[model samples]
Target: MAESNIHTLVHKETITLFPVDYRISRHAIFLINRNNIDSPLPLLSEIMRSKGFKVTTDQEKADYIMRITSYVTMPTNKNDQALPYSAEFLLSMREKLPVIKPLLVQSGDSPGEQMKATAKLVHNSNQGILGSDASNIISLGSTFGGGAGGLIAGAAASVIDTTASIFSRNSIREGLAGFEFSMTKNSGFLNQVSGLNVYAASATPEKPEALLDAAIGRAAAEMERD
Candidate 1:
């Protein structure tokens, strides 16, 4: 009798979201790597908790998993110069239990005078519920869009959504939104990153408790069906 590797197999699901543009994505990756140099595990664990999901560093124990990545791309006019570069982001979700149906969301926008505009648009489009104080999270800068002036403008929120659907099996929905306001003298980094130089910042749910409840409800409903 063969060992029951099948029964031992811990069924799981995973989703990965990454930035679309090469330059911005690379820079964002650098920032994440740099900031998380001390301990990446904790960061991942926190993110999972925020989304109302359990985290196990061990891959074998994971029943469902999701990953998200984000990057910005320069928007070009006929002149081939930066106008309002579009921020391109991608998400991939995978599941092993029940079935799998991967989903994707792509969004672009002309940087607005206020980060809230862009943030709200992206967040709402991605089906993210915003907090009552969401407006305080984003800070828009003049050069946020794109221009000769290379500066780290205001601050923006980073929202990534990767959760299973309550109504359908093997279905997934994901989204991400952020804005930056401020000016930095790191022209070299901006030039090296390529594409639009978008600022990236960490985010906390405006109403964490509400979001958690929603996430739990959805997850429980899905589990019941399974």
Candidate 2:
């Protein structure tokens, strides 16, 4: 009995987020370079690796790409304005590949309690959006600061919603809610001026390894059905 040459080539991808507001450059720099400083890129990569997938930082080497866009706000208005925040994720898989499919996920939120509200919208609207259940979805990990927290929360919620929307425009189970938890309390003048600085990326989806596998697996299964 000779060993079978059965190997799975898990394609690579990137995840990135970008803030639209130019006023918060300082906060964005701190979030990326300092504060909870470490880059989210490595975190995502490690997650993907745990799922038996190859992770890469080079776009040229990747099979797919995931981009995230987020907005954070620190209120300067006395009316307790509900600052608007959003997260846009674009997951692109190889068009010609047999085991993978491309996808795009986007989400947004307003200020106040709505910022924390985590109701999976797109999934609830239809079926075939997610990978059969909540467990199939990817958890990007936690972030600090109210603004950042809100942005991450909004994005996560949006991903769930968009995932559902992609599968079935009318899914029953709204993916998951309130997944984003804060690591620090809002304080200091810096917090006031800083608010939440938005950060986004357009990288290969090699990070957050679990997410990459789950997404790829889902796409693969969907492709088989087609």
Candidate 3:
């Protein structure tokens, strides 16, 4: 698939795609440089594991490959540009899959700041549970009027009766308090890939865990979409 090359502070897009069953066959591998990291592959694997994706060291068995590219922009006082040390994670899927999306793209000036942001992104993206077990919770409440319109027209209804009914309604509302619903949706698609499917981006501050988790979670969310 063709990729985009647009550069923005933070880039994100959900390309059109058909639904695919991620549970049946989901496997991925990571291709990250170790020079700038201290034994991060295992941590990356664990993070992906949390998203319900199979982490494989065998590149051939991977359904998709994750590659991280990083760049540093030196402080150019003349151009009024601040130092930008950032990393980008890319997902390359094998075969023609239904949907492949950039769930998140994050950038930061320092590794530590990036890690914190990455943790938050992962927590949000994985907000509800993953897979079919995913869902959300919402609570609702309502009030009743006890005057004019509160009573039925042409009925022998008295204020006492109306009040009783209102009380009953209030009781029902109380019982239904803290009601929740599912927030999960069928996702996992990408437009023709080029090079601009960035998910989350940050500036100034940086962190390591955040970058790792963001990249891993993004790829896993795409594959694990229900």
Candidate 4:
């Protein structure tokens, strides 16, 4: 692993809080209740910008008025019809703390030509959170930030087999992410769900918040496709 690449894993992040009053920017967007310092909101904003959904105040001109909420669901067990294949993952990499990357971004059918489009897609490997489960939603707070994140990363790094040193990016994609959206208002095709629904992680062993984040990212990436 190149030293330069390692920097991607750990870098500086300024926890910018959403405007308590209203989000006003040249790009119109109204983000509601996504205040978690470490969360899908930050990830969502990144996705919206990448997809041409400008972020700003002046809901009058906004393409999408999105309200994001994080929810926790019932736990899963071996017998519970195994989570959708997309939500499960396992990683065995030489670099234990390699920076986790975002979902593979791709432009999809835009809600409208003006609001729907995506930028270049770039990323490494990790989970299968692409268009997966619903009811088995989970919380991601521990995976991305707290101690569990640290522990999970550390474990993957050390899981390398000593005898069979050939660890060719052993990975299991986690697609255990889903959302429920409903639009309240629509003047143009650009106006999407009145509410953007996204959940956290399940109680599984390796619920990378990135998956949930990626789930949100993937949805936003493909949201606008005409």
**Candidate-wise lDDT, in order:** 0.23, 0.25, 0.29, 0.29
State the lDDT of candidate 1 residue by residue for 1-226, as single tens digits: 0221100011122221222332221121111211122323343234335544454554444432222222121222222221121121111110111111111112362212222333333333333333211222211221322342222332332310111111121111211122221112232343222111122211221121222223223332333333
Cα deviation of 195, candidate 4, in Å:
6.8
Better-scoring candidate (TM-score), 3 or 4: 4
> Model 4: per-residue lDDT, tens digit, 1-226?
1221110111111332222332223336655433232322444455456656566545576644554433211112212111111221211121232233222223453212111111000011112332111211222211322332222211333222210121132221222333333322315554323333333232223234343444454444434321
Residue 106 shift from truth in candidate 2, angstroms: 28
Each candidate's number of clashing pairs is: 28, 39, 35, 30
Question: What TM-score, over all chains together, does every model reach?
Answer: 0.22, 0.22, 0.30, 0.32
Over 122-215, each residue of candidate 2 has an lDDT whose tens digit, in order, gives 2133244331122223223323234312223335665446433434432221111111111111232322121111111111122222223343
Better TM-score candidate (2, 3): 3
Once fitted onto the true fold, the runs of candidate 2 whose alpha carbons sit more than 4 angstroms away are 1-40, 68-226
Global CA lDDT computed for model 3: 0.29
List candidate 1 stretches off by more than 4 Å. 1-54, 60-64, 68-208
Error of 1 at 144 (Å): 18
Score residue 95 of candidate 2 by CA lDDT.
26
Candidate closer to the true structure by lDDT (higher is better), 1 or 3: 3
| Predicted structure 2: lDDT | 0.25
TM-score of 4: 0.32
